[model samples]
Target: MTVDRRPGGVLELRGVAGGYGGATVVRDLDLTVGSGEALAVLGASGSGKTTVLRMIAGLHPVSAGRILVDGRRVDPLPAQHRGIGLVPQQGALFPHLSVAKNVGFGLVPVDPLARWRSRRERAARVREVLDLVGLADRADDRPSRLSGGQQQRVALARALAPGSGLILLDEPFSALDAALRGRVRAEVSALLAESGATSVLVTHDRA
Candidate 1:
């Protein structure tokens, strides 16, 4: 399956289809997100919105079709090797780790033989993202100590820490209360725009 490359295309899903055994949730989907653009997939609950994101993030296998990032095929690659960031529905932070440490987790080299970044460099990157998320003051606190909105921000910081060109957000604001959801949604929209990342966000909410 070949997709004519679109100029500035950062994320592309061509004829993508996937689902659990014997049940096709996403079928022949085609989508493209340009550089620094944000695409939202909105649907009712159980509508297979997150499945599209997982397929692109390499968390869920694509039964058919191609996933491309920056013009390169990424469906064949491991999740970590795809050079894409994913913010799962839950913040998925480590309760035992400090906010700063959780955000810095991606900065650590996965391969023992790979060159590790300097502690200062990693710390600086963590701090940079924490500031962007307005959580710099909470850096030393654990995820358990923060509010739901705050934890989500930490997750966003962690996802951005690696500076991935494409980010997949799976209902990032769903956990927040009604009062806080809108605020966090706006903040996230602004932050994504400021970061200049190509992002795909899936949610049940129309707002």
Candidate 2:
């Protein structure tokens, strides 16, 4: 398949073959996520959907082929160097940090004046992303005070705050109540579109 290169297209998997040591789960999976596009990797349980996300996030190694972001081959690069964002199913928020801090955590450890922007700038960016996901008012709240849905939004905001071109979500909304799934999905889709981020969402249901 011909992969289209767009300015913001953040991720491409070509002939990706990967799985646990002895067994292969995904083979020759050719996929491309374009700029601002949200592509769902739909498969049944144990069909290797999550494995694909893990491979993209560098949590798993590729046995063959390549993973590219921004036209650069990233299979050889380390996870942090790939500039990829991941929002796992559990939200994985830091219990000790406030919502704002959790969202801005990825910005920490950068030189204050180097890769880092001003604290106000970072806060503003965090606020902007939180607001996009409808969590601006909860910035000062801890993860413990938020509902599961709210926590999921916070996790998404955190992932987006780093301005990563691509986000890989591994069943991020699975914990929410069925009634809330649609709302969360809609919000996430809109936020990704507005940010011009290419995203890969792994879901079990084919529908």
Candidate 3:
């Protein structure tokens, strides 16, 4: 339940079992992701790939076994407290907020006494992540203004904005066209590699 944070990378699931009430989707599954590694969990529609991702993201309770982050157990932690970034199939962006604000949403408040003081710092972080995802110019743009691929990039930037060491991507590129999917996947893969983030990517298409 208690996981120790390592310098980076390393996500392990041991004998993980879980499902919706009596129905089990994932059973006795074990997996590991090294630092800066990209792992693809390829499966059919009902293969429980997303379920495994949710379990690692702490969205689903593990009925048995342990979930470890960098060699530390995290079974008892909440989703946000687990330091896992999950990018669902849907872009899941806020319609009213600009790209920058949405990406910076994960930033922790500076202080209980003076929250306004961290605005500049937060903005800087947002810009850094936006640029990393090649959307710096769209900081002020709304999600409605961006294309599907662009919106996914914004989502990726938002997930990375928090500096989480591990990321769980569940068919994040499923909405993109074939051409655009290749481009966006390459960009995201490169960015994650450069940032030294260990990621588990779930996809139905083997390609």
Candidate 4:
């Protein structure tokens, strides 16, 4: 279920197979994502695109195959330890926190003692990512006050804040209006490129 490759790409999935239970949704899937590359997995509803993404993000267990990042096997690592940036369709922002806090959530305390940053350092990192996603002005606003596209940008910024090696997008713009969707999609694409992040984006829309 695994194979080694040249030292370049940030992600590689080999012979991956898994599903909700014993039933397999994705079978023997193989893929690679080079550094600063963007890959889209396009499929209709129930095509297991999200399942594949979840497996990559370590949110769902892979019953078979191996997942690698930076040429190292990460199948045994927990989701947080894998250093993945996962952007689900719902945005998943914290309703109780400000936009700035939501984006800074992961940078400081996923493990309090293991990786603690000073308050100023954490704020700087948060601002850097918020600015990268063009949400610097909305940092103080709550998620409730932001538009769908804005919220998605915040979610992405949050993911990018931790400087993860890979970004997994699960139809992040599906909830936006047509114009907003196009705009945000382009922005997200450009942001990833600018950040040199290896990404796998899953969406049903072919556009």
Off by over 4 Å in 4: 1-9, 111-116
Per-candidate clashes, comma-separated: 0, 0, 1, 0
Clashing pairs in 3: 1-76
Q: Best by lDDT, which number?
A: 4
Residue-level lDDT of model 3, residues 1-207, one tens digit each, is: 111222446989999999896998898888888887889999999888988998888888899899999888998888867777878898899999999989988787534542223778777778878887778899999999999888988888877776788888999998888989988888888877766778899999888
Candidate number that wins on lDDT, 2 or 4: 4
TM-score of each: 0.91, 0.89, 0.90, 0.91
Give the per-residue lDDT of model 1 (tens digit) for 134-190: 888999999999988889889988888877778789999888899999988888888
lDDT per residue for candidate 2 within 100-194, as digits (tens), equals: 99999987644444333778867777877887787778999999999887888898888777777788898988888888888887777877776
Better of 2 and 3 by lDDT: 3
How well is each residue in 34-107 modelled by candidate 4, as lDDT tens digits?
A: 88789999999999999999988888999999999988999888998888889889899999999999998987
Instruction: In model 2, state the lDDT of residue 199.
Output: 90
Per-candidate Cα lDDT values, in order, are 0.84, 0.82, 0.83, 0.85
Cα miss at 198, model 3 (Å)?
A: 0.5
TM-score of 1: 0.91
